[model samples]
Target: MNQETKQIFSLRKFKTGTHSALLAKYGIVLATTAALMGAGAVSADEVTTPQTQPTTEVVAPATDQTSANVGTPAQEQSAVTSDIPTSVPADTTQDQAVTAVDNAQTTLKDNVSTAKDTGVVVKEGDTQEVVINNGNAAEKTSEVLTDLNQQDKAVKEATEKQAANQKAYEETSAEHERVVKEGQEHLEQSTAEVYQLIDQAKKTGLLVTETTTDQTPEYKDTKGLTGDELRTDMAENLELYQAAIKAGIALQDKSVADLKAALALYQANQKAYTQGNTALKDAKSSGVAELEGADGRQGQVIDLAKKNDVTIDVKHETVTPNYTDVKGLTGDALLKAINDNIALYTQAVVDSVAKQDGSTKDAQAKLDAYLKLLADYQAGKGTQSGIKWAENTTVEAGTAQRMTGNEPAVSWGNLRTAAADAIQSLDRNQNTDATFDHIFKINGSGTVIIKNTTNGDVTLKISNIQAWTAENTYLAVWGAKDGGIAWGVFATTHGTVTGGAGEGATGGNVGATGAILAMVKSYDYEVSTSNAVSTVTFNDIDNNQTVTLNGLDGAKLVKGRNVTQSGNSYSAGAGDVSQASGGVIDSNGIQFNLADAKTVTFSGSHFLPGYINTSIVAGIFGVASEVPKEPKKPNLEVQNVDVTVPEAPEAPKPISVAVQKATVTAPDAPEAPAPVEVSVHYYKMTTTPEEPTPTPTTPVQKAAVLPETGEAGSILSVIGGVLLSGLGIVGVRKRKED
Candidate 1:
């Protein structure tokens, strides 16, 4: 093997040796790749379903190194790209192949770093295969980069959704507040209107006193409330207020109408009373004028006798008519006294003329005129006074007209006895002849007659007296119908008379030759203010028949013990005779029967009529109905909005990427390249293990035990061992090549 032969032989030996070493290195690479692929291969069953939808993004390799903080989408893509090599160098020299292998190893480490930075969790007991092939390595790196970008997109979408939900919640809450405020205002206004109506009714006196307080509704305060609670309470309160307004207005209208009606009735009654009072006054004035004319005529008769020179003595000796003195008299007393004096004077003139020697024609004519005047004065029709004279008659039946505002003609006690005798005579059933005397009859304005035929001394007496005048004053009158009985007392305010002539009897001093000597004697009576009126009584000795007088003065009548007649009956122990035999007495009076000689009495009082008048006024004026008050407003409770604050999308739950190792062969390999283990990072989007909900009685449950994936520390140890073994093989091959 000279120089040429030796050179050729040396080169051949080196090529053979280099080929064997390369093949041995390839074998070692294949074996290591197989082991890494086997460790990284994870079954689909082991992987859990993703909690969220997976998003994909294709990431192109970057030209420049990027920041480690993968916070933004662009930053994340750049960071992942910085970890991957652009291309694999050709393995021509031993050092170059070693450098290429070193670059591949560095790429793998960078990818793992990027994975950690991007929040890709590498579960324990999981192996990753890093392919050193020129074409497939970039593809694997792009998968990891894509996962980072997809995670960022998911986070952005989640944040936008959360913002939209929050805005919607705010809008709903605002609308609810507006509705509540408006509703409350409406309720308050309605309540105020109702109160106004109530106040108006009271001020106008239209409110009914009896039910105003009880019917009035109370007000309620609503101070604190919010949201739907306030709205609902306001709605209910509004309804109540509206109802109160309606009812209050209606009540006011009714009260107004009632008041109008009552006022109208009161006015009508008052007008009627006024007219009646006027008529009463006119009638009283006419009686006074007629009585005055009678006095003038009596004077003329006396003067005419004197002018004729008839030798008629002014004083005649004869029984003079009973006459009361006319002095310091007023009202009905003065009128009666004057009339009586005139009648007595006229009688004196007649007696004196009869005793004279001759009576002149003028004297006779004047005397007759005086007689007619006297008769006219005695009857109630001429004087317009409430007095009437009934001449004595033999007939057993007669009628008398009822007269008002009249005084009694005779002593009431004596008259009662006479009436009792007359009534009792009817019960005797006797046939003896009887004389019926005309007695004074008195009552309200109407005619009432008494007819009886009997044998006993039948003396009839009827006395019903009343004063028709204004509220505070009254007029009363009384006079005898005829001069039949003797020795009667006539008392008046002016004076009194005690002794009088009997019926058809005359007495006086008379001279001889038929000449009048002295005036006739008059009745004797005691003058006293206290004995002005006689005591009136009714004594029934037989205890039989009942006497009922109806339509008496309501103010004067009083109910005695056991009185049974309606309308202010004063009889004691009387039977119920409201419906009497003659007719129903629809006015104030008394009913009584003579039981065991019982006597009914009367007493005067002035206060009762005034009280009755007051009652009438009250009935006319008081008319109204109750006024209702405002209804209560409801109290609303605070209602806080149940706002579910949307969580800030949880940052897309840190998309979990499964770093799986896969083997791929290079299509452009000069020889069979070692099977490359590529770590393809993808977003599995698995959820973190959640803690189970705890029951009321049990303690909080811990996070569910995740499926056993080896611990992180052990996985790192396996990776370290695999890396060391690969490095050792490269170093040995390099040492041999050197």
Candidate 2:
């Protein structure tokens, strides 16, 4: 029989519109093409067989098909029968039918095996193949590549984090070392400065006062410590300080109690000292100590003079009580008698003290001896050591007070009127012009004089009383030599005077003036002579009052000047000399003569401006001089230590990091079912199946082109030739029969 068959496969199913489905379709196309070629070859062989030849019509002995279970029901029902003509051999028909049956059975077995492995069902006795869908591997590959890219980026970020953290740690460590070194240097310098300050204080006599005890209580135990031991202890303390600085603590922030410990060390070292070598040298050069010694000797002289009934003058001059009593003594007897006299003996002590060398030790010893001898003499014991004979008479001890109270105040007007009257009274027709209210000229000399008419004390205030031109003259103002009112200038200059040129009882026209008052005494009107080698003489015309100096030099005079008057009032003056109270002439108003008077003497009670005991005026005239130079400030450098920076903080630990990877998900694929074979049904059964009619052509799809199957030149051409030759043979036989 001729048959046409269509087979349907039971294979794995998949959803459409997905990557997996697309892959399944492509696999099915390949499998179906191969199966179609095999079927075409078999159909060509069937068509070429000879139709006129006889074939066997074989009928098998009937068996119960219902009881058979070798295959499907359709297989059991199906049978093949062939009719053979008389001209053909019966064996040939039987053999041809049997061979056909064997071929069908073999094909069914092959299809069943293929269906099981591919998860597809094949139709029995048919050459059509079943397709199984596989998973979509292409989609998974794309996802895996994307995840790897993300992992690469994360690794790069982690590496950068580690590098940054490492750099920071290194920088912090370097800064820490630098800060430590700075702190070490600061500590060393600070220690050295502290020690230097202590050592200087100890060497000098600038003793630490008791006030430092409260500031430095912790240093109480430093009393017996040597300088080396103290320095060693101080160095040891720096170690503790260094540790604190390293740990980020400020040195200044330490407790007050702790700071006191350092201060205490300095105080203890300087307790008995006063001043450094610089000040001591200055004091020695200036003869300050010597002057003080002379003062003590003068005091001794006074005590001895008073005890031995000597007639000492008000000026502390004239050491002998009665010079007339020793006039008859001569030669060695005169010298022995003068040496035995208490007044000359004390005078010798005073002279010796005045001539002391400018040395601290010598002056101190002289002062001590004089003080002790005076103490003995005052206690009715004669001079301790044998008196050394001397000629000069200069003994200074106590200070005199200025007259005070509501006494009539003297002004420039009062002094001017008095000066005019004195000149007019002394010489008629003498030109006495008042240049200023307080300055005047007399006898063609720039000199004037005034008298005190008040019964009580009166203050004589003078302003601009200076030697302005070359004609150096004298000015004199006097009171009762017995009045004992002292005269002084609040400020004075030996060389030049300027500005203070007006006068009033309360106010005047003058600029602010600095106090030139001496520490001991300063004279108001001082005039130097023009002669290159002459002497200025302070001629005490009235010897009723004597004027004595602390020493031969004016530099040793104690400043007894009061502050200048301002607004109808005078300053509360300073110094024992300036505030001296009594009936003493305090003003320096006396006649000055630029002539050769070798010795400048003071035997009057009047304080005279013409006589300053200093060599500036007392030296040979026309010789320039100045007061001794003041001691210089100590040459000490306070080395300050620099503040240190705190140590750098420790570096933080590095960050732990890593890149995160992405997850990849491929499209889900359908699982393949096991394969099986089923019964086959034919579309048409006739002597020969007719060829199918051709359909309209369809447009091909654009898709991935599969590789070449290799059937183009050989397999397809052989199959087509077989089919054509079979058709030609069949047609030739038909025409002959016609």
Candidate 3:
């Protein structure tokens, strides 16, 4: 082990009951408290957020060692980040002073040593003999103890004043930090609002101005363009959108710059406060070390005296501070009592140091002068007062106010119908009490607004239409009315149309009264032509549905006709139906077809014919009908014609073959067949191929057959004799068969 490690281990092995061990424990306590106080006084200057969103700052809690559930060292350190004072509290300072005095007194009583050999206790054999003499060294040691006890009081009072000053600095600095943070949060929120506004403008087509040239060259390469490129192209094409985006970006930059400037000031102040607190902490810690070191040296001085031949008489009693009680006294009476307490504590210092070594004589003289000043102040003779000096100065922290701004306009739209429909879609069984609080967007536009009010009869105003169009677009909003129809279409006129039908909540009719099936607001229709076909799309404030129309012949104008307005006066000329003459209905041009009909087709000469129920209305017409029936037939022509049939070819004929007869012939007489000869030969191989060795067996040989020898001869003889007779019979039989 290293020398340092061995020393530390040896120190740890000391008994807890020893005087040095107690001093070590108290020393550690003092050091720990000092470190914590220093750290806490400075950490408040370093608060910061880890995210873009504003964070609520939490003030650190101070540690109280007296609590039963006091946390572990790590936790205690964490909690002691702010509000902890670097200087000791008055109560703690007082306690330390009293404890130190008690320790000094006890040590003096225990150490039996003196500079003179008088008053020595000699032990001879089993008996102890005491030699008594008046010793000047013992008397001097007692006076020294008394003086150190008095010095403790002055240190305690000084500590209290330092603590109060530190508290004021901490509180004021914390307030300044809070104000700075609020400024930062305000800027962040302001920037966020600007961004939200820009986003809304981009989404609702506000960023897009009406461009006349559809096939602009810059957009021709859009097929392979990235997201940013596409946005840039659109912005460049639309002057208003481009301007809006620039404004938003500029606002964000300005807000951030302002925030940064404010933050810089805040950081500067925080740094100054932290540095000041750190300096104060260092001073307090040094003072504590000095006081404890002086206390430790007192014990060493007594130990040295004991080693010498001098014998000292120990004092058994400890000196405690005494003060005159002034309870029930008011004003100056109480003040006088406090002054006297200070004076008495001071005088003790003078008395204790007077008999000490000549080196401490200077300190004794200074204490005596201070005691005389306090006595004169009690007698009202001097202007210098100790009470005034001991008191703390009051400090007030500055105010911090949070910044405020108008809520951002995300988007606004006519949401009367959309709100109603969303409300209707909610589960009636589960949330019957739920009210409509939804916002719907204008079709193809960034503008969105919601009908937040619950009152049924209220009319909602649509704002900011001038940004999109100079022309006035009127809407006839329909809403649900009482009993006349389960579904009603209502219209309330805003512009020039007077005595308009559907003015109030009523049933469907041509004038003044219309069924309230749905209400459309802030509606607009856009048309574009390409390849001889014009596409028409309608956008409304109602978000519940949309309408799109395609395949309209460009040469002919396709019109919108409110099916409810059926009178001859409302009828449009061949191609006169336009945005100016309003006949628009629910999204997708969907209308409830309650009329009983066998077939229906929404077709016109100017448009490509398609099923009106399925194509134009998205088949909502089928469900909107009062009664279910066969689907509508598309507008087209059909006919029937006969088909020709051909006869099958005849099967192929089978092939034929002629039969031939076989005949037997008999040769003339008695030629016997010659006997076949057979012969056998044998040879032996020397080696086998597989084993490379051959075992030979006996070879048998037979002569070539000689007609089986005599047997064949005898058979041939018999056959020749029989052949002679058979030949004659066979010739006769063959002749008869032929």
Q: By TM-score, who's the top model here?
A: 1
lDDT (10s digit) by residue, model 3, range 146-241: 232222222222233233333433443344345334433544465565455444433432331211111112212233232244334333434333
How big is the positional error of residue 123 in model 3, measured in Å on the Cα after superposition? 37
* Tens digits of per-residue lDDT for model 1, 473-566: 1111111222111111111111222222111111221112211111111211111111111111211101111233432232223232333443
- Greater-lDDT candidate between 1 and 3: 1
TM-score of candidate 3 on Cα atoms, chains taken together: 0.12
lDDT score, candidate 3: 0.26
Candidate 2 Cα outliers beyond 4 Å, as residue runs: 1-135, 195-348, 351-738
lDDT of each: 0.28, 0.27, 0.26
Q: Given candidate 1, what's the lDDT at residue 707?
A: 34
Q: After the best TM-score superposition of candidate 2, give how far the Cα of residue 612 lies from its true spot, in angstroms.
A: 56
Which ten residues in a row are the worst by lDDT in model 3? 1-10
lDDT per residue (tens digit) for residues 1-738 in model 2? 322111111111112223223333432332233334333322312222123322111111112111112333443532321121111221222233333333433443443344334433333333222111122121222121122222222222222322333333334334434544666565445444444544444453333321111111122222223224433443333333345443322222232223344345434323212222223334333333444555555555445445544433322222222322334333344333433443333443344344432222333333444444455556653222111101121111111122221222123223333233222221222222212123322222222222221111122222232222212122332222212222222212223222222111111222323311111122233222211211222221121122332212332222113323232212222121211112221332121222322223222122223322110111111101111122121111111111111111121122121211111111111112122223331111112222454653663332223223333323434544554464345435433443
Candidate with the larger TM-score of 1 and 2:
1
What are the models' TM-scores? 0.20, 0.17, 0.12
lDDT-superior candidate, 2 or 3:
2
List residue ranges in candidate 1 displaced over 4 A. 1-160, 163-178, 188-738
TM-score of 1: 0.20
In model 3, what is the error at residue 213, expressed in angstroms?
39
